[model samples]
Target: MHSLINRIMPSASGAHLFAVVALAGLFIWFGLMNLAGLTEATVERWLQPHPLAYLVTPYKTWLPYALGAIQLFAGVMIAIYAVPQRWKRVSYGLIGAISIASLSLMFTNPVWIESLGGFPAIGSGQGLIKYVAILGVALWFLGTKGANEIMLIGLILVLGWIGAMKFTGPEAEGVWPLLTGSPVFNWWLTDFGKQMASNIIGVVELITVILLTGHWWNRKAYEVGLLISAATFVVTLSFLLTFPQSWSGGFPNLSGTGHFLLKDAVLLAATFILYRD
Candidate 1:
């Protein structure tokens, strides 16, 4: 099979160019948004349910500016081949640091879906999960061979763990709101029953994991697994459009459910790289 870069990119250097442009562009977009205060409200909402609620005011006021500056510099440093090696290292380090810090927020933030009795219901914490993939993006840009695997691991863990959770009651109920919002998925609830429908999805996800794992023996299996994984993200992202309740304060302001779906974008990117590589 032809390497995707060969078919789509002009040359081997195109791979590096792709990473630099995509990753740096994402950071640059985020930096500009944060700097413009467009994300301030969203940031404030995320902090509200945290134990450090007292820090919300101070944090919201300054975090956007600080993160914006860091992101802008990091984006520039990574994108410019002529940038000093020292600055590139600093940019990579900053990306790693911020990614780790954001991932840590999952533990500290309120994650419970109160109506479903919390624990496995996963709320605001879902928003932070993509930092894992972002960290992988950083590693890739920094020339790590394991970067692709890092992202694959992210997809596997998300599917494997959440797939397991689908067997439980709270999880089934927790996803009910999202499932009902979609005309395509709603039939599953009515026809198969809630738990059964969730179980079906869980089975598919687990099978995809199995396929990804078994790829060592059958390249075809690996290839299929990546496609399935990519499809999974595409479906979830569709929820952002199908589910009206996805938004807390309209378009740009996302609710917990919105965050959950949006994070799948990064997971989708994970599958894309795995397939490309």
Candidate 2:
């Protein structure tokens, strides 16, 4: 098994380089997008319905630009080597902070479809959940001693939370748009009922949770879980190509759904890190 994995997998350094470059690019791209005011309209809308709309409304005009500057700075600082190592760590912390802030918005925005009984049936919440991965990436790159185990734990938490959501009726209905827009997964709805399709996904996700949890006790289970986890991220990220709703306006300007799927790239990167020997 070790021989097979080595033959199939890229070197750890190569994978690490890819993740750093890819995430840096994303940060830069999003920063530029914000600076261009491309997403100003979206931010405007987000502020309006927010619980603290009054306080945010005042800063609405300049907020996007500020966001752009922060993201751009973080991206640039992390991508280049001229800066001190501490600065790179700061950039990673910035990205992680940004991710945490984004996740906090899920509360203001309500991830659980309240109409569908709200606890676990995440609808619009999918957009924010991958922030977990974003945080994981930051931690991973920071090279903290236990960051590898931390990332594994993070993955398990997210997979368990989101996977459990799939079992509920609301989540089954919630994925309708993604499934309908997705060419590969659309068949799941056609071949099996909505609930059943969701159930299948739920079961598989739960199995991964079990497998990954067995990482400490069983090496084989850990490796198998990593493979499955990798496949799961790869497929989800593929939605960018297969789903029409993935993009809006043009390539850089993604729709809400597109943004939701975009974070999977980093999540996939975390899985790569986990595969390291």
Candidate 3:
């Protein structure tokens, strides 16, 4: 196991490079999804209920496209900046754009309180709030050296906590449809039954958490954890394709589940960053 970790762990510079590329990939994919009109309804749903709705209503039709373009441009810039001799001006641009975009969600998304849970309670927002980690990662790539470690710890917390929740009744029920729709996961239902299947998944997630957080103690475990985490995201992301009902009101309009699943993109990126070594 130690030898395997040594083989897989990247050089410090390589890790940073991987983190940048991972983030760029996320931005590009999300941008394309928006430009393709696939996330329009989801955007609208979040925007329409906000206090600034009227201010944004007139531009609603084109806003998503514009944002998509910006994300695409930022992604391209990040990719370009990854080159050794590249000018870092683009990194600055990305920092500004991503910071504004991510921070703006606090006001634009109405479900923040309910999803994130208020104060003492852990709510669905636990997933959404992790965007701050992405923001930190972007900043780290741009210039903040310490941000990488901070973001990694943040990822451990969020993934660990959420993974732990999978053992609880509501979360288990909530994820059932996703599990059932997934070919990779569906067989668990027949073989282990719902409760056992869910517990199995929960165990997988907790193991991932332990491995990720325990990297300092055992790099081998961390590398293995990263593999499991990546695999987990891959399975969850597959839900978007396997379940047509992910989108409602026809192709573009996302149901609650669709919105919930879409956030996996960012989490996927974080996993790469964490495992980049």
Best by TM-score: 2
TM-score of each: 0.72, 0.86, 0.70
Q: In candidate 3, what are the lDDT values of residues 1-277, reduced to their tens digit?
A: 6566546555567666766676676677667778987777767876776676798799999988987887787777778844542444465456546655655665556433344354323454565556666766766656667766766665676667667766666666667777777787776563776667777777877777888776679876777877676667667768888888788765555555665566565556656666663
Q: Candidate 2: where are CA atoms >4 Å away?
A: 44-57, 81-86, 174-189
Indicate the residue-level lDDT of 46 in model 2: 56
Task: Give the candidate number with the greatest lDDT.
Answer: 2
* lDDT of each residue in 158-267, candidate 1, tens digit only: 78777877887877777777787787688656478888888888899999998887546777677678778877878988998998877767876566576567667656
Question: Once model 3 is optimally superposed onto the true structure by TM-score, how far is the C-alpha of residue 97 displaced, in angstroms?
Answer: 4.6
Model 2 agreement with the true structure over 51-127: per-residue lDDT tens digits: 77787678889999998999999999988968899998999999989988777777776566787677666777776
Alpha carbon lDDT of each predicted model: 0.72, 0.79, 0.66
Structure candidate 2, residue pairs in collision = none
Candidate ranking (lDDT, best to worst)? 2, 1, 3
Q: Name the weakest run of 10 consecutive residues (lDDT summed) in model 1.
A: 1-10
Error of 1 at 215 (Å): 4.3
